[model samples]
Target: MQRDKFLKEIENLNHPNETLVPTHCSYCAMQCGMNLRVNTSTNKIIGVEPRYDWPVTLGKMCPKGVTAYQQTNHEDRLLKPLIRDDASLKGTKEGFREATWDEAYDLIVKRFKELQQNYGKDSLSVYGGVSMTNEKCYLTGKFARVALQTRYIDYNGRFCMASAAGGINRSLGVDRGSTLPWTDIHETDCLFLAGSNTAECHPTSMFRIWAVQERGGYLIIADPRETPIARRADVHLDLRPGTDLALANGILHLLIENGHVDEEFVKNHTNGFEETKQVVKEFTPEYTSQITGVAPEKIIRAAELYGKAPNAIVLFARGIEQQVKGVDNVSAYINMALVTGNIGRPKAGVGTITGQGNGQGGREHGQKADALPGYRKIANPQHVKEIAEVWGIKPEEMPEAGVSAYEMFGLMEQKTIRSLYLLCSNPVVSAPNSNYVRKMLKQLDFMVCVDFFLSESAEYADVVLPTTTWAEDEGTTTNVEGRVIKINRAQKPLGESKPDWQIQVELAERLGRGKYFSHLKTSKDIFDELRRASKGGNADYYGVTWEKIEKQNGVFWPCKSEDDPGTPHMFLDKKFYHPDGKAKIFALPYTPPAEEPDEEYPLRLTTGRVVYHYLSGNQTRRIQFLKDMSPEPFVEVHPDTAQKYNISHEEKVRLFTRRGEVIYKVKITEAIRKDTVFVPYHWDFERAANILTNPALDPISRMPEFKACAAEIEKIEVKKVQ
Candidate 1:
């Protein structure tokens, strides 16, 4: 009866004048299923309705997903290409003038040729983002290496998913965000989430988390802040910022001492356990408490709960992965799942809370500086030969690997890279040390940006090309579970805006690289090429046709042939991805942050996302509803810290670091640590938390320590009127 009533209510939601087009949301990796309501006569996106048939999210939608359709016809949408003639107004919105596509293309081609001719091919760089479809990301790599012949190409994922990717690949020999399907989450006996704020970041997955606890399963959380999920956890290991490595090592030590080790499994299917065991031997609960600031009793409870469960899953996000030893932290947590024999089966494994819409697939295809299609390494001769054959070029024609995303700014400052082609990202607001990043961006000789709106970063562009929104394009994206899903077109392109794929193809034609890209006339054409390019590689997508995706709801990767079903649960036969078919257990030592708290800067400052905004607040902040909900950023201060600084709630305070400073309204609460302060990094300019963030990169992942830095807060004195 309940099922029938739910079906009836869903049927009642249909409108007579609107057509419901099935698609996915444009925000985070949850990729919540939604049906866009399109006006029948006008063919414009009107609103959105829940897609109850999709299995991953069911009918669930977060606030961002609910209002995603509003972005299609937003008033701030860029309707034409812009050209900035006045160099003095580079960082402001006052210098751009409307221009034709031909004018923009001519200017971009001329400038690009002059730079390459004078300063060599490596002078050009392409900085991209993962929010785009897999097709665009794949093409972006080919365009930079084959069309422009430049080696400096990197994406925004370096700052977001690189640490998780680095750790998972090193241990398991393959990088899939999740080892098990999302449907198995609720059936697990225990969930140990580290450094992730799931309630705000990936809210659609909360139902499954809550269902686990409701079924008498345990939930443990590790974070500096007492987040909403932490408040309800069986054990909240409120560790200090940048100390996740110590906390994870302590739990692993306890798990092993308590006889939770699966001796038979480790002896047969794993290597390096003895070495790892020796490294964590000194990380006792008492020793860990001294470093992480969490009680030893809480650490014991967390280990016991996880070790006693019959089936368990370990999950994490940027909080732990944004530190100087982020890769080490990830591997330490993965050690827990491996030691407990909780993986390679249903209701058990490890997963990452992917932050972007296509974070999984975007990294797989090629946007990273060192990668190729199918996660192939550019330095490998065999990998280069395979991709060269696919692109109809010689293996030697492929350029060597370049630096990471943040390092590209250093190259720009040194005049090594004089031009840039940026898309789908707003680095001026997102990158650490915003003041320095802005200065480097200004130093570039020429820059072109492709986006739907004039983002804070786009204001400095010489040419800004208008691009269509997700509702106006058709492509595929890999969700958080490593499931390959389709994004359908709900409406036609608005105004003169085009899709990023179309823009790139057209630009390639103008740059005399027509033969390589002109063959791809549509998104499906690009996908066909992508399938062939990814053949026989790690992230094989050869068998995942659009028809197959529609039939299977969504397909997991490594589907090699048309008859082959996708891999839903990885390592099902207890066979790992290493050459010897065995997973690795790494022995990583705990390392503190590059910039620890000092006497002068006595507080630890951490930054993260809020429930009301997405990365950089480029699109979400433009929406009326979301903007009203979170108009600006604020600093979260503990009561004791506020009292120590003589600050009060809602009062403005200046938060500073060695890099820069920003004044934010104080929000006093007991949810945060007394020695730490928290700020959201969604706003831009003076309010951006990146202004105070440290740019110390992890040696392995190249991920900056955006979560922890030395900071100090001061109360601003008010002046009395004379």
Candidate 2:
């Protein structure tokens, strides 16, 4: 009956004048399957329909996914290359004039050459984002090292997924986002979600999360705000922001005291348990409550629920991973699963809720500063030699590793990195301490932005190259589940805009680096090279051919050869990737936020996404429906805090931190901690939450502290018009 009903729904979506092109949503890592309705006569995408056949998000589409098609044909799209004639108008949208591709490429080459000749090759830098296909990301690393010959190449994932990557890699010795597939989520006996607001951020996955509860399984959440998912959780540990380490340790202590430790698993499959136990022994519930501000009883209850479950999965997102101790927080949570022996099997493991579309594949294929393709370290000589062999360059010619994304801005401030090639990101709105980021961008000797829209960051560029949307490009992206799925092209490039891969190829030729890139004429050509480049490394994809992806719906990696079916459940044999074939349990110590609440800034401030917006609101803000749903940013304040500050609901208030300040309309709600305020970081300019966010970097991941900072709200006095 369900199959027949699904067939009927598909039949109703069919139209004689339109052809349905199957693909995945170009938004979050859920990568919900969808079919783009393309007008056959015009070769343009007209609408979108949910892909009921796709197993990950069967027929489910979030508002962003439903309106994703609108981005390709939107009026705000950059139709031609833009050249800024006046250097004085760098931070505004006033100086750009439409130019041909030749003029734009010539100007970029001339400026880049002049900068490199004047101040060494390291003057040029590449700032990338992970929203693109794996093909584009792989080529981007090659483009920077081979063509540009620069050591200052980093990506936006530094702010989003770096901590999760660092933590998972340290604990399990491999970072695949999720150990068990999304299909295993519903069957899990318990779920301990830390810092993720799955209901709004990845709405399509809610069905599976809710299904766990429908089966009488327990759900535990740890967050500062009572998010939609937290409201429904059996236990909500509303800990103070930046205190996830303490809360996780508190739970670990109880798990040990209550005799929940799997002694056999700890003795065999893991190491460092004795040291970890020693560290957590002092993290009693009362002591932890003093640090995290979550009740002792709540912490004990959460530990009991998770420890008692036969099969459980631990998951987290930016909330815990966007702090100074982000990596520690991640490992602390994974410790729970490791101690409970709830990993290395079906329906049990640890995973992260990936924030971007290709967060999994993008990080793997070397967009990061210190990473080579296949999660290989650039610092390792053998890894450099391996990648150099594929690029046909001598190993010595490869540049050394660069700094993280935010640190690149620091280099720019010092005039070390004079030029920047920015793509797939809007740092002006997304980066922490964005006011300083914007200032540094304006001071760049040469700046180029490649994006479909004129983002806030693009407004500061000397040249803006038009790039095609996802619907106009064909490639592969690994979903949050680490499944490599093919994204089919639904339409040709509208106007003169080109795909980012083609743009880089053309740019490389102009810069006299054609031999390394000219052979890649199509996305498949690039993917074929990428597959070989990724062979034998941790994120091996040599066997994951386009044909295989199409045949299997999607193929999970570390697929080594053609006959290999791919790994869906990681560490199935209980063999970890560490040298000793054992997962590590770190003895992490608790740490406070870089900037805690003080006399001047007396409240905790945290930032996150809204259902109506993706990162930075570059694409979604242009869609009328998404814009109408969330027109501006607001600060969520507890009623008691609002009253104390003499602020009223919907009243404009000044929310200021040590970095900067923004005026937001008050949204009084008891869903948030009385001592904390929440702001969605989607809007740009003065409304952006990044303005108030701290730029303190995590020691291991170099992730900026976006989730917690000291802040204070002031009631704005409106003067009468008279």
Candidate 3:
């Protein structure tokens, strides 16, 4: 097999002595490929060169990807371990002292052992991040159960992908974000994007959407705010916040009533269409208009466009998923796909616009609270047995799933889970009702955070260990299209930092669970184990190998063997993953947001991300260019709403909700709805939008409602110069 063509072309840019390393971005699920311009003399990564030949992104780097390498040399990069003093640990005053690696490790192991001995194994917990490589995520889950013998483990992916995952699994047989490759967008007649600011959040991915639009394909955007994507939409339905269910139901009703559905395909390939007909019958355009704030005519037009299109794909993201009825919101979208017979085919299906870097694969592995590797359910006895056998442990030795990420923190408040091992995630700023989450974290008996930067979440940890970022690590990351691509190490670990998997392996050895972890000598070793563990599971990787990745661009999952080329698009045979090989449809009804506007709280608050920063501003905040682009968090207020509150452009406004309150500088614009205010949730404690967000969870998915809450804005009084 020949080497990748991009590698050879990049040789000219790098010095004769220096190396150019290939790796996927650690930002969004798009996973744009880039090569680190390394200086062999200094052993430093000076810059990033786009890897144009990568299959998913085609070398297009978002703002986040271009500046992501700067974090390695960030001034605030955590270079040493810090052990909080007794006073700081007790919340008396802020204090932490630098300590040797051995000292920090001994303290962590000792405290963990004491907690394990006194409060039982379930008392220890771990919280992972989706940004981590597949190897690190797998090892994190393994360490939590095998090393500590604890059933309390979860990850930040719960908050990001739980709703999408649950919806996809229930409606279809499986839950890979995209049923078709990104290139399929060009072949579609239309692209229905709801609840996703595709142009800003996934800048590189927008090229695919643009390709469709350029070819006379229609664009339908449904969102509360007029994002960049919405401005250019063929039909932009500026729906009210948290009303995705109603809008989707209305669309389904219109499609079915207009006879735009493929009746023959529905009868042959799907079940539950009759039930959906009955449920959507009541969601007429007139009724749904009252709830969703979209005009009756606009809703009908959107339905007509999406329904009439011969080939189209519907995509949604956090705006739809981060709500109290997130699962139903997703179900509603899928229902439309079913009646329209848009699934299990080329250029037609439901896809989730996953936000996190590995949002799709991150949830597939056992890092989640209620899953084993390969996207297998923890409740399934056969799945438990299979994974247990692969792990070299008795099925009985394995415990049931623990509480989710949010539930784990709540357990801490109840004095149940006393120890928390947080790696690669910063829940203090990312979690809904974060003010309370911070308090719950402080109540933990022991807390250890592993990260290269001293993030807001790590500031409260009892011990903080500097861990290497993606630039200094070698592993595999699954992209939005379900392609697993190998990421090579570009530079050595800076200072005393270590890769996250190495830290977990070393910590496990210290915990006396060394024998089971001995086989994991490298990221590849762990990857091979993941392949064996996932052989017959949902996200089968047994067919993929590192050597194979070098030969091909990247391999998609369900690859049966080394000779297999791997499937870029799934369900081409029109067969679902269900027992009867048929897709299931939901007859979901509309439900209003958990918290709606009222006399006391007359404005709806919606939170999202800006183009420049990633989640929680953990790494992006350190990048000078990104920080310069977006200096601080600001609220987007409609001119009508701002006028009522007596707030002007760039003036500070106090936005209050039932959960909490904060004062953010307001940017008055007509881009937002008069009934709602929008804020980016990337700031710290003083201005974090999550502080005022509700923690109401979707019963099925357990995802928090971060998008909609009863909120009111008031102008902040200016102080005199005196």
Candidate 4:
């Protein structure tokens, strides 16, 4: 019987030599290189492997990349367009009535025209998201600015990486796609990992950090919580949240006072040295240590490690830029890098680790409110004229820069924004202050959402356009190191779903703005134009053609010609693009957090991601394997604090803030600080963390304070309802 069963199993096997297709991960933007293999006969993806030959992890990937196959052909994916016949029905649909692609596009065109004709074009707002491909991002910007002529346009980047974009542009005259590549960090002798947890967020890259440690390289981490990476660091400076500016300025003070300053490098490579030095003198270690809650000795040590190291790489993330004073924090770090003569050299960099999969690409391609492709400010007359001339339109025809995400959501509630178009994002669950964002979406006259699944945001849409997932799409994405990787589709659409760029093109043509999309009949056409537009910019890809990039796996920007190998590290010669031909070191002061512990809310609250779940739980939670790894939400509280509150591990507790409260299971551990609690912002059950997140946005970048807030905890009675 066993031999007969084995023979039957062998007979069932077919097409064993299926070829694999090359592609990029569609999850978060680390863009870990990958390949997906499909059975030739069944056309079914059978396995996945890392792009080991490629740079940046040498093709290694985290758990997210290994399990990306689960997303393709998943049963929960949206295969058809869904229209809400009744707003009050929720998912209780009156009917799902499948329609042709033309029907869906025509319906959207009709509704959009009605909105424009009834309300002014400015009354309609389009929200681009980070999950989109480069082709979709470019087309979305073109459609909104040309076809719709809407002044209200922004994306979820405001919630995460807007400040990084603003600060980088202000300092370097352009936005993302780093001049520096990932290999630069490996060349450094010292790694100043501040306000970031790469061990947890980007585990594959952590191996590189381990390699750095093996080489006797120093590691210094600055964060409020002693994260896993921090515990392993040579020195961990637990600075108060939102006080990074003070810590950075104090380090600058120590470097100058100890004569560790690279005078030759500074004089030859930087500007504003005298004024910046004078301003930083006041931020002495003793003075800033008090405000930042770090010891003076530790502050001095951090400065020594950074200043004395032959090469130091300064890195930050949402923890630093997702605060009310985010821009100031970034400005201070930039000054520190420039003063130490740390930037523009191999392994000596000051850069932000972007959060979303395409946050870097999205901002670079002009999805930002104030930007056009290539980081050209929309408000700049010369830039506007240049883009307009390229698009064959009048410069004055373009609308002024508009409100950001927070302001746009507020306007929706105020009826100022009548129509809302959200692309590939779930703002209902992802936005800070969930209740208010949900209510505002409900109040909007019409809401249109484009996504691969029926997410929280799609639930409220009047019309939901099913979008193609990464396995069923084609385009390009820039990784954290600014390497542009291609994403070739491996599967066809499930039903009538289409790629986002195609939808945008069809809609534009239907709106009688076919001329706007006339130059681009395909995504490759747009990619070529993007290279042309970005010719002289910071992320120059003009030299990288399709044939060369595919053959090479990927290439970093500044590959201006087909014959040129892409640049891996930026600013190696200290040649800055500033008018003075030198990087400017700004003098900035630190401020307190937007929210803090008070009488009512007597503890500090911080939010972050977990190993198993991605932001908003849009896709990760749906995976049965991943869900089993971390099935429910929980709050990490120190045992001492939990005992004082009479809370126990696995016991239910209610976490409250001024805005809202959520009940979650408790995990009492000594790994956390005494007065602070850590909650992963993954679950969206009754206790979504974003529900209690403060909406205090940065005045300059308009990014919400997602890192730190004030809150209280209480034991909740787990009552069972019959």
Which candidate comes out best when scored by lDDT? 2
> How should the candidates be ordered by lDDT, best one leading?
2, 1, 3, 4
For candidate 1, write residues 63-150 as lDDT tens digits.
8998899899999999999999997888889899999999999999999999999999999999999999999999999999988999
How many clashing residue pairs appear in each of the predictions shown? 0, 0, 0, 7
Against the reference, the lDDT scores of all candidates come to 0.93, 0.94, 0.87, 0.79
Tens-place lDDT digits, model 2, residues 1-722:
74786575467466677789999999999999999999898898877889999999999999999999999999998999999999999999999999999999999999999999999999999999999999999999999999999999989999999999999999999999999899999999999999999999999999999999999999999999999999999999999999999899889999999999999999999998999999999999999999998988999899999999999999999999999899999999999999989889999999999999999999998899999999999999999999999999999999999999999999999999999999999999999999999999999999999999999999999999999999999999999999999999999999999999999999999999999999999999999999999999999999999999999999999899999999999998999999999999989988789998999899999999999999999899999889999999999999999889999999999999988889999999999999999999989898999999999999999999999999998888988998
- Tell me the tens digit of each residue's lDDT in model 3 across 1-722: 12564466456464766777788788898889898888788888877889988867788898899888888877887888888987345332257889998999999999999987898989888999889888888888888888888888889988888999888888778888878777687679989998999988999987888888898989999999999989989999999999999899899999999999888878888888898889889889899999899999999999999989998899889999999899888878888887888877788877888888888878887898889899887899999999899888898988788888898878898899998899989898999999899898887888899999878888778998999988888988888888888888888888889998888888888989888897789999999998888889988888999988888878888787889989887888878888888888788877788888999999889999999999999889888779989999989998887778787899888888988889988899999999988999998887898999998989988899999999988777888998
Q: Roughly what TM-score does model 3 have, to 2 decimal places?
A: 0.97
**Model 2: lDDT to the true structure:** 0.94
Model 2 residue 64 lDDT?
97
Q: Count steric clashes of candidate 2.
A: 0
Residue ranges of candidate 3 with Cα displaced over 4 Å: 1-14, 87-94, 719-722
The TM-scores of all predictions, comma-separated, are: 0.98, 0.98, 0.97, 0.94
Stretch of 10 with least lDDT, candidate 4: 89-98
Clashes of 1: 0
Q: Residue by residue across 1-722, what tens digits does model 4's lDDT show?
A: 74786575445444465767878777777788777876667766666768776677777787767788778778888778777767775422343455566777777788878888887888888998877777778778877888888988888888878888777766655555355777767667888887887877777778778777888898999887888899889889887666788888898898889887789978887767788788888988889988888899899888888888988888888878888888878777777777777777777877888778888877776778888877777878988887787777899998889889888998887777888888977777778888888888878887788887777777777788888788887888877877777888787766777888878877888889988786687778888888776666555777877777788777777678879888777766666767777776776756788898898888888888877777888889888778888887789898899988988888988898988999888988776677788788877635588898899988989999988899899887667998
Candidate 3: give the clashing pairs. Answer: none
Which portions of model 4 miss their true places by more than 4 Å? 1-17, 90-97, 177-179, 717-722
